[model samples]
Target: MEESQLERNRRNGFLALVLRPINWLKMLGEEVHWSFVIGVMIVYGISQGFAVGMSKVSTMYYMKDEQKVQPSELQVYLGLLQLPWVIKPLWGLLTDTLPVLGYRRRPYFIFAGFLSVTSMLALSIQRNLSLAFSLLSLIGVSAGIAIAVVAIDACVTQNSISHPSLAGDMQSLCGFSSSIGALAGYSLSGFLVHLVGPKAHVDSIPSAARLYCFFSSFYPLHNLSGVTLTSQGVFGLLSVPAGLVILVGMMLKESRVHKFTHRGVNEKFLDAGKAMWTALKFRDVWRPCLYMYLSLAVSLNIHEGMFYWYTDAKGGPSFSQHGLFASKNSNLSLITYHEISSWLNSDSELGCSDVLFWYGMQEVVGSIFSVGAVGSLSGVLIYQNWLKDHRFRDLLFWSQLLYGASGLLDLILVLRLNLKIGLPDYFFVVIDEAISMMIGRIKWQPLLVLSSKLCPAGIEGTFFALLMSIDHVGLLSSTWVGGLLLKFLKVTRTQFDNLWVAILIRSLMRIIPVFLLFLIPRSDPNLSILPEEMLKMKKGDNTLESENTEMVSLVDST
Candidate 1:
């Protein structure tokens, strides 16, 4: 029988050789696939729902509902809401690496979900929201969630070793699951207030346009008099989904795998210390990490931050005109993403949107399809081609560079539109996003897989969690960073014209990190080692290789 990496560790440290249930289960039937899809669905459903739902209420649903808040205030509010997530890395380290109930990863994950559900429920009870309560609610939900994310990523990474070859596919399918959750959550949350009205549709265009004035929520109240008129008072109700996921998770024949797991005081400390040291030692790793962080930061910033411009702020190509165009463009992208990938990519009419909702959805759809068809496949092709002499260092580098350039493409698209320069700005933005997603899909999973392969035995979960934690901080930053940049753009709630410079500056900032990706070692320091020899090689520690490893981590541990 083959001595796996863990078995090899017996010679290194008694505690290091202990094999968890996860390893045996890897040989079991690959049932984790369903859980992954569902888990991801729940994750995206809740996480993204929180991210976008608040914005929807402020931008569309609650606009007329709250008079005290102006577009300016909402602009700042959107930026402020992400503050908890910005520091989420700290939260992850708290529950993940630390102990609770004598269990490190499990207890925190369970409690994290509970807090998430409770936070959602609490927020829903408050129909009348103040900035303080809202921020608190956001924080509570996000805090629990930040912890949940780390746990989920760790679990997924461990679970994934079973079908290790499918890591990329696993990640891609997870994307779809997340999309399903987002679209489902977004679509349903508004059903009560926006779709079926307590009152019938009003006659005439003006009355129809202002129909929000007459609708009432499921929760009855006299104050609801003009409640539906403005989306001002809506609660995210993210708890509903959280509750559902919890129930479903309970049915998941518990991951008894932890039972086989062994962790001694000294062993765990060394594991964590070694992992942390390795994380810091890898230049190639951090390079891609930095690029990803900044890219997502800018993309999301442009996405959420620019909405004020699309709405009443810049007053783009008239709401009606922009709406029709944007609607058409979005529809096109959505079809291209989900439908066409099913081999249905036919020539068709494109749509555009003035509404942030549809435009954003369009981008989401584009990214999904790109990930599966073009992006993942492209990276796989590159990897396959590199099977000869190891050149993935360049592959990884170029992939990241392309993603950065895609960011630059965003600026170019906006410039073209702003200057009435070439093709429409939407064209540039949409294509840029698609390419970005493609490169992103290609770049990220390889990085993760490489990390896992190279990590010293016994510290897989801890180190994997750390990598994800860092990337997420970057993801969170994407949400608010654009808003900060927009503050300087000051183009206004009415004039849509002069803010291209912000895009340019952000793109330039984003590009700087791509060059840094070169700092990562070009090869896996551990894959070359046999399972028997692996334990002796501490995870996060590098092995010197003769395979022409242009990109490698380190032989040193913190």
Candidate 2:
């Protein structure tokens, strides 16, 4: 009988391999409701991941080409967009304590969807909006995304509590959905921009007429008859995610909450504040929290300055909205290519002379984003497999070191040092993006784990939200500081001579966080960082405990 069983196992190995995924899917369906699964995919996967990736590329191009915002000012405006995330705790609290039309999650999700859809539609259809309005529209979009994320996070938290054994699996599902959606979104961003063209057509006077005016030569004039989609059209497509979000709201299985009292809500808020204050009094909690804030604040995000340089610098490989590639050494080659394309257009009576000039060129920036997505996912895998068990202090120290080291790639790219080293601009940027994203993700993973570890027992939800908000505040601070740095260095729309200096400053500041490593706990992750008394709240504390046991589940699931 043993021999027969061994033979059967050997024969079914290939079949088992094929059925494993099917079996996993079956188990997932049994463990989690289908509505919850779909809601997560739409919220995290489409709204957060795909829409965000596409929006980043489109917004940069719009601000740079249409709004004409300089790198320094753009940095400030970009920072403003993060305001919603900085106040994420408020959104979480509202979802927890306040319900509209007797529904908590569904109303917020629907409102988020409505907000996102309107903002995206506004951006897409309106061509000549003022800079202030454009920024406001973008902020609205950001707010919508943030609200939806908070709502979905609340759902995840509730489910984690209801099904304790499936908490890890649920988190994994969320992470995987986000990563895969991000990868597809980023990989397609540049191609879609290139295909749709990054900017609306400016009504330029025919070049023939201008030449005729200057040279008094009889140049033939022809109307541009070719039609192409613009970046606005791409933005219009982003409405798909918002539409899905609305559907998720309508389809989500949530029971009606018929009870409400303003006094009760106020008391809950007071309890949450008191609990958070109590948790922060613990040195074990506040130390790491302070470190997390400092680590992010000191990094100094100068991405706008670097982005403008990447697309506009003469001596560097250019990555632009239109299929643009320019380098100091390749000017003649580019001119030749343009002239050849022009000649081809001359032979075609139906085509515009300049329309096809950039044909077949790659959207280099979008491709870099795509590559970075892969790197981020790889970082997640690496941490899960190897680094998840490491002591927090050691893991953070090496990741920070590598993070600072990898930042030098930006300096190299800015200085055109990669070209001197025989590596082309496009190839080098891809490698740099991948490495930087991987290191950044690695640095962030430990911080997330640490944040989860630090959350106290009863008020886990509110405290965790507060911690996330602190991180966003740090991000806001970093962005604003980077903008000031760029302004101080005189980096401008066409002037990038000092951009390298800004990069150097940022890279150097990335190392400052390393010295603050003393603030992090050196204990293994398996051990609780909090004291026993803190973890064990009095049984009589019903207000905070009853309400937030579900909330802390969100932390553990993360």
Q: Against the true structure, whose lDDT is highest? A: 2
lDDT by residue (1-558, candidate 1, tens digit) is: 467766766666654335432342243325553344445545555554333433343333243234344333454565555555555545544433455544455565566667777776666566667767766766676676666565555555554444455544445444444444444443344343343222222221122111111111222212222223323223434455555444433433332223222344345455556655765565544554565465455544465334444333333321111211123224432221122222213333331122222222212222223232343344444443343134446656566566656666655544444446545444444455556655665666555555444333344455556656556566656645655566556654554465677666665665565555554556542233114343343322231111100101111100
Note the Cα lDDT for every prediction shown.
Answer: 0.45, 0.71
Evaluate residue 454 in candidate 2 and report its C-alpha lDDT on the 0 to 100 scale: 67
Clashes of each: 35, 0
lDDT for model 2, please.
0.71
Highest-scoring model, TM-score:
2
Candidate 1 wrongly placed segments (more than 4 Å)? 1-41, 44-106, 160-164, 183-193, 196-237, 255-275, 282-300, 313-315, 318-392, 395-456, 475-484, 495-497, 524-558
Using alpha carbons, what is the TM-score of model 2? 0.81
TM-score, per-candidate, Cα-based: 0.61, 0.81
Worst 10 residues of 2 by lDDT: 210-219
Query: Relative to the unseen true structure, what is the Cα RMSD of model 2?
Result: 7.6
